[model samples]
Target: MNLNLRAAILHNVSDNDQSQLEDTIVDAIQSGEEKMLPGLGVLFEVIWKNSSEDEKKEMLETLEKGVKG
Candidate 1:
């Protein structure tokens, strides 16, 4: 059985509305499970890929601050 984690994650969440997506992310984080990291990463990848340059820079800044703070 070849399980593609990224594909699976994307497929599951792709149809979700904004509120559903936010809930998924919130639940994943609040659960504090290491297994959820890859799913979150996949979500971030989609968001990053679709973002504009300004959005990416803002995200980077937010990430940097998050890492520091």
Candidate 2:
């Protein structure tokens, strides 16, 4: 069976409102389950694609700090 994980993840969360999306993210993070990493990666991919250069820089900076911290 061929599975398109990115598509499946997007389809599941595409209709979520801001609050629901927040809940989904928080729940996924708090769960610390390996399966959730792909979902978060898909979400970050969408965010990175839509973000401006400045936003991407800020995200990189934050990620760097997070890694160091």
Candidate 3:
């Protein structure tokens, strides 16, 4: 079976408002299940593609802090 996970994840949330998107993210994080990681990664890829260089830098910095914690 061909599973286009990134496309599937994006399509699932494409119609969501900002608050709904936030809730989805929060729920995924709080759940801490391995299955959620792929969806989060797809979301990050979308953010990375659309982000300015400065925004990418900030995200990396935040990620660095997160990892260090």
Candidate 4:
């Protein structure tokens, strides 16, 4: 079977409004299920690709703090 996970994830959420997207993210993180990691990673990939340099730097800084915390 051939499956494009990134595309599938995007398709699933294409119609989601801001609130729905926020809920989906919160639900996925709170679930703490291994299966949700890939979807989160894909979301992060999209965010990373679309972020500005300053935004990326901020994300890295936040990630560093999170790791240290």
Candidate 5:
């Protein structure tokens, strides 16, 4: 996960307007594509990096519920 590569991927996602990226994410999750999980990890990493501690705590709580459900 090079920062430069991650930035490039994020830039590409942003430039493409995220619709396709959303679809890909949905497909990956629904299809249980384990490999695609890393992409999600990257996304979470980006968000977590920029988020406040409270936001991160809330996100983690939400994720825990999602995982349980």
Candidate 6:
């Protein structure tokens, strides 16, 4: 939706230890397990706390669109 919410989601999604978190998200979407989306917020927070500015911006844009619609 808005930039702040998008940034938040990106922050959570980027927190996962696994490099495949993005893939996992895609799989979840394909499987229709939409409930798992909330966990992305946690991952986003983790990532947001530790990420570089460039990475944060990219992820923010991507997750914002994903979460918003």
The candidate scoring highest on TM-score is 2
After TM-score superposition, what is the CA distance of residue 42 in candidate 4 from its true location, in Å?
0.8
Give a tens-digit lDDT track for model 4, residues 1-69: 999998999999989999998898999999999999999898889889999999999999999999999
Clashes of 2: 0
Order the candidates by lDDT, highest first. Answer: 2, 1, 3, 4, 5, 6
- Model 6's alpha-carbon lDDT is 0.71
- 1 or 6: which has the higher lDDT? 1
lDDT, residue 11, candidate 2? 100
lDDT per model, in order?
A: 0.96, 0.96, 0.95, 0.94, 0.77, 0.71
lDDT of 5: 0.77
Candidate 3 per-residue lDDT, tens place, 1-69, comes to: 998988999999999999999999999999999999999999889899999999999999999999999
* Residue-wise C-alpha lDDT for candidate 2, range 1-69, written one tens digit per residue: 999999999999989999999999999999999989999999999999999999999999999999999
Off by over 4 Å in 1: none
Per-residue CA lDDT of candidate 1, range 1-69, in tens?
999999999899989999999999999999999999999999999999999999999999999999999
In angstroms, the error of model 3 at 11 is: 0.7
Candidate 5, residue 28: Cα displacement in angstroms equals: 1.8
Question: Per-residue alpha-carbon lDDT of model 6 for 1-69, expressed as tens digits?
Answer: 355765665666555656578786677668776576665555656668899999989988998999999
Show the colliding residue pairs in model 1.
none
lDDT score of model 1? 0.96
- Identify the runs in model 5 with alpha carbons over 4 angstroms from their true place: 1-14
Ten consecutive residues with minimal summed lDDT in candidate 1? 5-14
Q: What is the C-alpha RMSD of each candidate to the true structure, in Å?
A: 0.8, 0.5, 0.8, 0.7, 3.5, 8.9
Model 2 lDDT, residue 9, Cα:
97
Query: Where in model 6 is the C-alpha error above 4 Å?
Result: 1-23, 61-69
